[model samples]
Target chain A: MAKDDDTAFDQAGFDEALRRRARMVEAVLRQVLEQRPLAGEIARPQRLIAAMQHGVLAGGKRLRPFLVMESAALFSADGEAAARVAAALECVHCYSLIHDDLPAMDDDDLRRGQPTVHKAYDEATAILAGDALLTLAFDIVADEATQLAAERRAALVLALARAAGAGGMAGGQMLDLQAADAPPDEAGIIRLQAMKTGALIRFACEAGAIVAGAPAAERERLAEFGSAIGLAFQLADDLLDLTADAGTMGKATGKDAAAGKATLAALHGEDWARRQLAGLVAQARALLEPYGAHAAMLADAASFVAARNK
Target chain B: MAKDDDTAFDQAGFDEALRRRARMVEAVLRQVLEQRPLAGEIARPQRLIAAMQHGVLAGGKRLRPFLVMESAALFSADGEAAARVAAALECVHCYSLIHDDLPAMDDDDLRRGQPTVHKAYDEATAILAGDALLTLAFDIVADEATQLAAERRAALVLALARAAGAGGMAGGQMLDLQAADAPPDEAGIIRLQAMKTGALIRFACEAGAIVAGAPAAERERLAEFGSAIGLAFQLADDLLDLTADAGTMGKATGKDAAAGKATLAALHGEDWARRQLAGLVAQARALLEPYGAHAAMLADAASFVAARNK
Candidate 1:
């Protein structure tokens, strides 16, 4: 383990870098949600645009976009291309949040301390906004402006679609719903979490490799790193749900426990969960050791995920 | 302009072709939705997969897929490639229908004489099913099985995203919801219809040219043909709503007028709408004149759109 002084230095650098990338992601997203219609578009409906903005522009840590940027930096990918892809990933993230917060889903009234999209705009508009955002993610990736080659763009689309589709996020959501009636065992919980959250985080890291045209070996390592951090991210989240308040989280916490959803954190107790998170973070860092200092920021990111309080 | 005998012959050929393509699309979709998960997928949740199949496998005209196949035939595109693209397009169409039938949206309980997705499954399952289907459309398009070049695949994804995004289908849904509160004028109605219904139809035609690698001029012409027929399809639908009963339509009829929504056929009387439909079909047929007999099936499709009773 590092000394306190070295850890402090790394924390400061990581905080600044995360904030910088978050701001960049915010700017790109703001521009993407502009009312001005793109070529071949008929017109942007104001109500829908406003709803999308409401769901997306609400502040969060923007950790997923940060992962994409830092991971891409490992291979020296073009910053502009990575930024756009990061924005696209954020769009998908926001879309899932909006849909998940629907009355039929998680039924949360607040997100990031503001009214959810359905509460801010009617349910119909919220649904449309989410749909549009998801569609726009693919649009952003495939558009010429992303600056990647056509093959790379198509590969990205395929990867994103797989991550977000039936056997991934949406399927995992169904599993979560089912778990309410019959909670799954440890393996089931792992699979459910992997599909629900792990898939997108893995994609975010792997997207960097794809954008940089990194070799398959590097991509695999980055993806493994993503999986490790993704596990840590979820474990930390479950811990926060148990330990943090709604005011701190800016959304409802303790609901997973209330709903009786099976989680590793809930199953194994806090001490075990914390120790596991530390191990996962270490594993994530080791996966990037081949890139040495070039991957220092990503290694720091793994620590941040394990250590985040909110 | 054709004699009664020639018209009968053309209609017979067109009907058989449409059925053949519809069956082909159904087979492709069934295979895509199999219980076996794809590469990188953790697992295919049975409930979600069943819901998707419920939404997609229910019978309909499959006109959109037929349009894709016929349009691709115009450019002599590979049959298998066109079939996959046609199946992908149908997925988007089914997703929109599933969503549109939600309680917060159109609220229809029935589609094609069967329960709507939300009725057959729960509202949450319906939403996830629609989301998964939409995501799968891109997956199918970007997958190697589509057999298109990388650039072409990227182009297809971009085009599909635009046609389905905020400024197109979802945007149009917003406009339609607003129209319920404050009905739009004729121009607004046209724009709404174009975005909601016309955009996808146009993409269906244009995708054929894209799959075949046809030149820009031909692509534009096919798109125009799609627009003409799209207008015809909506007009015929409105006319059917006014004239046909719920039983004939296999779903609710006259709901548009009941909801006080503005439509071209409702704006003008039946005679005027019929005249407009005739004129649009003529325009559509004329646009395909360059293809001569090779365009015969597509031209028949325009006539069918105008003349269909349901």
Candidate 2:
């Protein structure tokens, strides 16, 4: 759907790259837990460490964090520094996933075809894992990637916090609950989509650019790309929730209808949902024209948004 | 139960003072939030701001943030700076409250005479509210406060994140779940409380002093005060869960009995629980001796911790 150019993006290579990147992220994040002055390390109590590792390591598309690394690579003098920036985004993303999978939230039993964190461990462990990941996101930025200006880095952390926070994903989620049963027109749906998905995606792209010291103008452009991609991502997701079967999608498929969700299927119908997704993908791709040579991976990543089946 | 020092502390005034302090904390928090960029501020379409405000101001003890401001005041700081620090702690405390109220964790319906965040709003809002509060806590700390040193303030922010995140309160919560219906022992109970309760309390005191530029060596002494009061506070909470009526408590009471939780009461019986509370109160009060004249309010606060019916 996002294929503006005829050249096929390396889907296989991108998948492979994401997997490798996720492993590296897990390695870096685990290093945080392992560092010791034992008593000084905030009393992790063995079990907590196990639970966190279990959730964070469970496989999924490590898209946002990968974008963090990739976007940083656009300007970072050091490749390793870019990787660390990437790792920070992973922390934020993983925390969000942990919360999203909780019994009280999305209530999914399966994530990435494995037991959701709450199912793999317990609800409390899942909550802690999410909290740890969220805090550790800032800790990593503060401790490892201080190459950015102190105030600026603080701003980046703040940016991530605001995006992933109550007003961002959390707020979006609340709107989502209301939109499911309440009357929300197209604008309301768009607003919910922007927050629930766009906030983090924008943060990921912006964080990358922020760390590498991209100009405000370029950063804003990248943020636009992120927001566009985020909307397309959700359009695809709502479509998937309706169309994908359990065997292919891993989780409970078509649960959206049962839940009475006002998804894309309900609003635009299947054909129009597909058409709207394609249009968003085109717009997302168009935003990348200025980044041109620099944003190849991000462009590829964005283009893949509506095209990917799962 | 801690009334052995009844002549030393005033219950009514302290309660009233605490209430006044809590309201002040909430107001200051609202002011700090206004500093955020309006573009990214919560959207009205989602009713995100309303949900965020509701979760936070739904009435809490605000003790931790109060400790932050009070500790800062002990060093003769500007009133505005102290208010910012106090409000930051309240943000953290409120986040924890929102998450704690979720069905996945403590599963309570009421908090402070109102419906829990999840109940009044929805599960998604409650999660976001918690996430938002946690994120905003760091945002406040990282933003420029009038008199704080960047390095020292950073240390305090890092400390709070550690305490609030995976390794501290979160880790404790995980352990709390793991310990449920398993076994009851003194060491286990202590570990649980220290993580769940002690972490935030310790940060509250230390963050205040950090902002005020208390010498690093002085932190150890203040930490002792925090540690003692933290335990006493938890003990008081556990006891309240056992003895307070639902009407007076504003939530379901005797929940420990219903859930068969492992508190000191569940572990050692009510007689042993009271005796242990007495011991902790003495230990808590003893740690404040060095504060001299100013310790009266702090000490009074500790005694009030013991005497509260709910």
**Candidate maximizing DockQ:** 1
DockQ of each: 0.89, 0.42
Over the stretch B1-310, how does candidate 2's per-residue lDDT look in tens digits? 4355532477778878788778778787776555243345445333556666777776777888777766766666555666677787778777787888788788878878888878887777677777767877776766664345556545666677777776678777777777776754888888888888898888777766777777876566667677777877887788788777778887777876777678876666667767676676677677667777776676666676666677
State the lDDT of candidate 2 residue by residue for A16-62, as single tens digits.
87777677666676676562513434567677677667777776777
Of candidate 2 chain B, the 10-residue stretch with the lowest lDDT total is B37-46
TM-scores for all predictions: 0.97, 0.85
Candidate 1 residues lying further than 4 Å off, grouped into runs, are A1-9, B1-9
Question: What's the lDDT for all of these models?
Answer: 0.89, 0.72
Quality class of the docking in candidate 1, CAPRI style? high
Q: What pairs collide in candidate 1?
A: none
Number of clashing pairs per prediction, in order: 0, 2
Indicate which candidate wins on TM-score: 1
List candidate 2 stretches off by more than 4 Å: A1-7, A33-42, A45-47, A77-85, A144-149, A238-247, A252-292, B1-7, B10-17, B31-39, B42-52, B122-125, B144-153, B238-296, B307-309
Number of clashes found in candidate 2: 2
